[model samples]
Target: MEKIERGKALKTGRDYEDIKFRRKVFMSKCVKKAMSLFRIVTLIGISYIVLSPMISIISRAFFSESDVYNAMVYLIPQNGTLKNFKLAILRMDYWKTLGYSLLYIGSLAILQLFICSMVGYGFARFQFPFKKLLFGCVILTIVIPSYTIMLPLYMHFRNFDPLHLFGLLGIGAKNWLTTVKPVY
Candidate 1:
């Protein structure tokens, strides 16, 4: 009778272990499924945010005048045409404008890249008097809206002056707006 009771006890212990194993497997599967769903949702949201504007712009570019007026036209234009591209190229004088832009803006951009790198290196490596104040000014310039300073900057450019030195030197204010000197 004791041997039979010991056999029954071992059988119940094995059943308990089997139940625990099944529960662990079920929980892991649930966790994995939840994580996958979260990832899918996040990807869809990011796709919509990034693609919506680009899709709208492409659709609008292809849209006809009648398509713009039609309320039902959305996402896809009913009458697509390359007329807009031709008009834009002709009106803007594409080649000449592109050449001028590449010459001026491209040079400035390269120069700016070098200047900024040197300035950043200086700021990162050196400690100077008024360093914090100068850094603060740089931050302020970045944070402040360009439009707020636009009028004053425009006026200053129209009559270039540096710390009243030009005035003291008896040199007349030079108009920088007419020249590419402002790029410097």
Candidate 2:
């Protein structure tokens, strides 16, 4: 029994000093491979868990009337049909809504493009006093959440509606949304 400064201590009468070292290396490699496989299995399991409900709902939507209830409950369908598609389209009023949405989106896009281009051009080209300050103020307004001003805006619209001010221009108060002929 003697203590050495550097190398591993050797036993007097055994032919297996390196056996433990070999076992440690083998175990570490196995553990690393196992962990990698475990991670891949976990990710696949999570994907299936997350997408199962969506897939089930879409499949159920195609099931026939008699099979729909069972399919929804069991997440399987023995029969399929297109009745859901017809009901969905009828409830949504697809064509009418599509036309109205297209018109609304077109007008909104044109107005936004014109206004943004004009504002951007002004900011880039103009040299009025306090221009940078005004730009900073506008940027601040954009960055700020609108919920802060929503109450104030609601109160202003309710109390000081511009439609009522049309009386000052000798126009009678009328439904502004229906007839938008300007009075100001």
Which candidate comes out best when scored by TM-score?
Answer: 1
Residue-level lDDT of model 1, residues 157-183, one tens digit each, is 778777867888898777778898666
Q: lDDT of candidate 2 vs native?
A: 0.78
TM-score of each: 0.57, 0.47
Q: What is the lDDT of residue 44 in candidate 1?
A: 100
The clash number for model 2 is 0
Q: What is the lDDT of residue 9 in candidate 2?
A: 60
Candidate 2 per-residue lDDT over residues 1-184, each given as its tens digit: 2443456665543325456666889999999999999999999999999999999888788888788556344565677678889998999998899999899999999999999899989999988999999899989989999999877765654434465576677775544333444332
Model 2 C-alpha RMSD vs. true structure (Å) is: 9.2
Runs off by more than 4 Å, candidate 1: 1-10, 102-184
Model 2 CA lDDT for position 64: 82
Q: Which 10-residue window of candidate 2 scores lowest in summed lDDT?
A: 175-184
